[model samples]
Target: MQRSKVILNSPKIAIGSRADKYWSENGFLDYSKFIRPNLDLPKSLSYGSNPDLLRTKFGIAEIGFGNWVTNEDRFNYVNGLIISLYDLNKLMNIDYFLGLGLLSVSFGARGAGSALAHYESQTKIINVTRYHRGDESKLARFVATGGMGSFAHEYGHFLDYVGGEYVSPHPQVFALTGGRSVSRSRMPCNDRQRLRVITNDLLEKIIWKVPNKTPSAYYTRLAKFMMANGIESDYLIRRNELFARWFEAWVSLKLRSMNIQNKLLSQAKYSPLIYPTENEVREVDKIFQDFMKEFKSGYFIG
Candidate 1:
C-alpha cells in the first residue's frame, strides 16, 4: 500500500492563548499549537492523498508556537518547525511544510523572527506574523503601517530550505544554504563581524550618552526604519544591490514624507544623523515618487 502523505497546513493560534497551555504554560513561544492543525487536519490543508508521508519523508517534525521572543528553548523552538524531504520520500508523498512561526516580525525595532532563524540550526523557520490580527502597539503599528513583505520573503527562504535548493544569498547564508546555487551565492547580508562590532561600538556611545536605553532598544528603532524603507531584507533580495539601494531610498522617502521619526526610548535624534543631505535625500524621494507613480499606473509590485 502506498504510504499516506501528511501535508503540514498553516496553523493559526490566538495571541496569548497559550499562556497555560501545553508547551506555553510559562511563556516563550511554543510551536505546537499552530503546527498541530496542519499535521492533524490533513483535509483542511490539502496535503494530497498520503498524509503519513510527512513523518517518514524528510524527518518531518510538525511545529507551532507561543511567544517566541523571550528566548526559551532553542532546540524546541527550532524543532517545532522542520519538514523533511527525506522522510517524505520514504513515504512517497510530496507535501509542503507550512511554518506558522513569526508571521509578522515586520514591526518591532529588533529583528525578532530573523534573529530566531539566525540563531537556529534549522533553515526552515517561517514568519507568519503578517496573517495575525492584534491590538499590541508595535504589532498593530506593523499592521497599519504595512510591509509584511519581509515575512513573506523570509517564508521563501523556508521553502527553499525544505526543497534542498540551498543557495547562499550572501556569504553568511552559505552555512545555512550550502552555497549550491548562483542565486544563493550572490545574496548579501550584514557584515557578520562588522555587525557585532558596530552594535558594540554604537552601544557604547548610547550608554555614555543615555544610560537608560539599551542597544536592543536602539536596534529596534533601526529595524523600524529599515522596515519602513523596505531594506529589512537588504541581503535577501537580489539584483546587483542597485534594486536594494533604490528600494531603500524609496522607503526613506516615505518615512520622511510621513514625518514618522524612529523614536526609541531615551534616544535622541542627533540632528546630523537625522535627515542630513537634502540632495541625497531628495534623490531618494524622487525615486520613490516615480516608483509609486509607475506602480499606481500598473507596474511592479502592483
Candidate 2:
C-alpha cells in the first residue's frame, strides 16, 4: 500500500464505553471510573508520512485520562507517536512487512511516571504510555522525546519478526567459504559464521579504531554495548532482540542528528541520544541496503 493511504488508516483515539471496557478487561489502567471522553478524535495527525521501499501500513491510538487533559494534549501525543513511527519507516522502509497494527499510547498512573512500551507478536499491537507523578508538562515532554523513542523500540520488535530472519548471511557465508556446505548441523551455521565475520570486521576496522572510527563512536559504543549487554550473543545464538535494539539505536541517532540544535535530547527521560558521524551513517546505510537487498531476493523462504 502507498504510505499516504497507510497513514490514512492510522489508529484513532477513543475513550468512551468501548475504550473503557478494552482497557479494564485487559488489565490496563482503570480510568473508566473517573475519566470520560471529552475531546473529538483527531482525524489526521500533524506529521507527514515518508514512504521508502517498504510499503506496510500501521496505526497509533492515544489513550488519556484525568480532567486536566485537553484536545491539544491528545493531538501532541498522537503527533509525537506518528513522528517517531514515520522516522522508522523512512530509515528501514518498514512497510515491507505486514504493518504494526493499532499501536496504543496513553498517560496514567499505571506506568508509574515512566515510559512503558511493548510489541505483542500474537496480537500485532504496539502499546506505549507515559506515567507522571506530578507534572503534566514534564509528562508531555517525556512522551514527545523518550516516550516516542520507546514506541519506536517496540515497533522495532515487530520489524525484527518480519525482516530479521529473512535477511540471513547464508549467501555471504557461502561466498566466504567458496560455496561449501559449511555445516547445517545447527541449521543457521552459515548465517552465524557470516555474522561473526561481519561483526569482527566492523569491530576491527570500524569499532576498535577510535580515531579512525568510520561510523563514529555511537555505533562503536552500540556494538560494544550489545556485546557487553549480551545482545550480540542473542543475535548470534537466539536471533532475537538484537535487531530491535539496533533499530532503537538507529532511530534514536537519526532523530538526534536531525534535532541537534533542539533541546530534545536534554529533556529525554530514557535512552540518551547518540550522534553518528557522517562515515558512521554511510556504513550503517550500506549495512541496511545489503540486508534489504537480501530480503528482496526471498532468501529466508528459500
Candidate 3:
C-alpha cells in the first residue's frame, strides 16, 4: 500500500508579541516532532509538499498558519483545521482536490491554550499560548500529549467521514447517547441539537460514571474552567464529540500506559488528570482496538 503524504506550511505573518515570536521560532517544529511519533501511523505514511509526488490520491497536505480572518481585519481564533479530502467530490483527481485534501492544523497565539474540534471542516485546532511562553519543557509535554488526544479525536472524525464507525461490543454502554451506534454521515448539525437527542438517562449516567480526576493542578483547573464554560457538557451529550473525546482520552491513557517518552506521561507530574476510571479506560481501549482492526484491514494499507 502507498503511504499518505503530508505537506507542512507556515505563512509569513507579523508577530505581535513575545509569545507569537516564540511560536514563530519553535512551535511548528516542536509540534511536528511531538505529534508524528504518537500517531503510530503505518510506516507507509509520509510527509512532503512536492506537487508532482503528492498528485496521487493518498497525499495529505497540512497547512499551518498563525491566524485566520472571519471578515476584513476580524481575526477568528483557531488552533488547527482538518479539511476533508472528499469535500471536493467532483475533482478527486485534480490539484484542487489535493489542496482541500490537506488537513489544516493551526496553532493560535491568542485564546486559552485548549484543544478544539470543529465539525464542519473536520478540523482540530489547539491554542499554543501556554506551551510556548510558560514552562517550555513541562507545557510542551502537556501540549504534545493533549494535542495527540485532540489529533486522535479529530482523526476519529476523519474515520467516520471515510465510512468507519466508533463502536463498543456492548450495547448498554450507548444507552445515554441515543443507542449503541452513531455515524458521522448522520450526526446532528451542532452541539445544541445533539443535546436534544441525548437521553436524560445517558446524561445521568455520565454525571455519575465519568470521574473528575486529574494528574495536576493545571489539569484540574482546566477541567473546572471547561465545565464552567459548558464545554464539558458539549463533550458529554454530542454523539460525535463524545466519541472523539473518548478517543482522545483513551489514546492519551494508552500512550501513558506504554511508558513511551513524550507520550502521555511526559507530564507525569500531572498524571491522571481528566482521566477516566480503570474500568472505563479498559472499555474504551477495546473499542479503539476493535476499530483499529477494521481500520487497518479495510482503510489503512502497509
Candidate 4:
C-alpha cells in the first residue's frame, strides 16, 4: 500500500479522514518521508510491538520518542495524546500542539524528570516528566496526568518565544508592528509558521498599553486574583506564565475525552495553584477570539 502523505506543518493536518487512517495504521514511523538531515533511524524496528524501541513521529519531531515511557498505560496515554493531538483533534488546536519541536518524555523523578516540565525555546523541545509507571494509585495517575498538562503548558511557552523576535517572552498577537515576517505565505498556518507572522511586541495591545498610570490590565487582574486567593508567589504573575496557564486552561476546556478531562480535573482541583482562574482564561478567550476575527479580515490582502 502507498504510504499516507502527512502534511505535518499545516494546521489542518490533523483534520480530514486521510490523516485519521494514517495514524490508525501507525504510519508515523516511516522516517524516510519525515526524517530531517543528520539524523538516523534504527533499522528494522516495529511499532507498538516492542516497548523498548524508540518511536519517532517524523512529521511531529526530528528525534524519536523512545525509552521514555516506563510503563504500558502511561505509554499508551502519551501515544493517545500525540495521535489525538495530530490525528483525532482530541486535545488542542493543531497549531498549538505542534508548537514544540519534540515532546521528550522521561519516567521517574530521579534524573531529567525532576522538573514537572519545561520548554527549551532554542531547541523547541518540551521536556515532560511522567512519574506514573504501571498500575499505580489513582492519585499517582492524577499527578501523572497533571504532568501531561504541564506538557501542554510548556508548549505555550514555545508559542511565546517561537518567533525569536524583539521584546519577547510574552504573549504575542500576530501582525502589529512587523519587525520581520515570521509568518509563512500560507493559510491555516502551523505554530512555527504563525509565529513568524505575529508581532514581536510583548502583548502590547492585549495586556500592556494600559492607561491612567497603570501599565497593564492583566497584571492588575492577576494581582487581585493572587491576593484574593491568598497566593503569594511571584512566579505566577509573570507574563509568559500567565499566557501559558491560560493556554493550558484553554486546552483543558477543549479536550474531548471525558476520561482525560476527569483525570486532569482531579489533579487540578487537588493542586489548583499552578493553573489559571476561570475568569483569566475566559478573558483571554474573548480577547483572542476578537483578535482572530480582526486578523482574518485582511488575511488575504497583499
The candidate that achieves the highest TM-score relative to the unseen native structure: 4
TM-score of each: 0.25, 0.45, 0.42, 0.49
User: Whole-model lDDT, candidate 1?
Assistant: 0.30
lDDT tens digits, residues 136-243, model 3? 664354344333234445544444433222221222332223332432223232333222222222222333333333223333444575677667443433444545
In angstroms, the error of model 3 at 68 is 10
Model 1: residues with Cα > 4 Å off, grouped in runs: 1-60, 64-123, 127-151, 162-302
Model 2 CA deviation exceeding 4 Å by range: 1-73, 94-115, 136-146, 164-241, 255-283, 293-302
**Predictions ranked by lDDT, top down?**
4, 2, 3, 1
* Candidate 4, 82-144: lDDT as tens digits: 433332123333332342334333322223434566665555565554445468764455345
Q: Please write out the lDDT profile of model 1 over residues 155-188, one tens digit for every residue.
A: 3233333322221133344322332321322233
By TM-score, is 1 or 3 better? 3
- Indicate the residue-level lDDT of 223 in model 4: 62
Candidate 4 differs from the real structure by a C-alpha RMSD in angstroms, to one decimal, of 12.4
Residue by residue across 35-128, what tens digits does model 2's lDDT show? 1112121333222221221123344332333343333333344344434444444455645232433333343212323335555554445544
Error of 1 at 238 (Å): 5.0
lDDT of each: 0.30, 0.39, 0.35, 0.40
Worst 10 residues of 2 by lDDT: 32-41
